[model samples]
Target: VPQDEQDIAGQWRTFVENNRLDAVVCIAAALRRGVLDEAEASRYQRPAVNLHQPWELSGLGQLHEAAQNADRLVCFGGD
Candidate 1:
């Protein structure tokens, strides 16, 4: 994430945690943008990872699962 988006991401993470929400980040997209969780970072030999708890880096299957379980699903797209 860029410096400007860090705060927003933190806020979203907090909101998800507080609301007991599930957040599944598309692993391919995140990796393409240099966003990785601890496991991914280690696997890719990255010194650090920008993603943390409450935000899961996963595949589309997880998204499908979330949609199946959720009352409503909202998706955001980016360049």
Candidate 2:
């Protein structure tokens, strides 16, 4: 079976933390979908996003309050 992208990305978290991968920004949705930028994505099976993907990293500055809550984080709900 193909490895779950989320699951695979999860293990990346440790590296992110140990390496301090706080650089760059991720879209809330992409984070939720298990796409980490060498940090957050690899951390949790659940996403750390609190917003939607449309915000994207580039325009995140526009979503002031939303960006603040980005790291608020959320665990994935089991089906």
Candidate 3:
């Protein structure tokens, strides 16, 4: 990854230590920022949910298809 992108991912990783899934959006931010690649994403099999509104989400439904198929980071069943 580029230095600047790496820097951004590093900062976000710090936040992940603090907020975990809430900070990283079920690994979405990490994936987008290149902090977690496809292989890494496939490793997180736990369920996750964010109660915030649709507009409040960052990459809303980016993982919906995968979630439906029982992949890592389930992203459904919210108001």
Q: Which candidate has the highest lDDT of all?
A: 1
The candidate that achieves the highest TM-score relative to the unseen native structure:
1
Please write out the lDDT profile of model 2 over residues 1-79, one tens digit for every residue.
2554456434555566667654234467565565554345445654454433222243356456555778764435668
Q: What is the lDDT of residue 30 in candidate 2?
A: 63
In model 2, where do residues sit more than 4 Å from their true spots?
A: 1-6, 23-25, 28-79
TM per candidate comes to 0.73, 0.26, 0.24
Ordered list by lDDT, greatest first? 1, 2, 3
Off by over 4 Å in 1: 1-6, 69-71, 77-79
- Summed over model 3, clashes come to 0
Report clash pairs, candidate 3: none
The lDDT for every candidate, in the order shown, is 0.86, 0.49, 0.47
Which candidate do you rate higher for lDDT, 1 or 3?
A: 1
Count of backbone clashes, every candidate in sequence = 0, 3, 0
- 2 versus 3: better TM-score goes to: 2
Which of candidates 1 and 2 is the stronger one according to lDDT? 1
| Residue 19 displacement in candidate 2 (angstroms) | 0.6
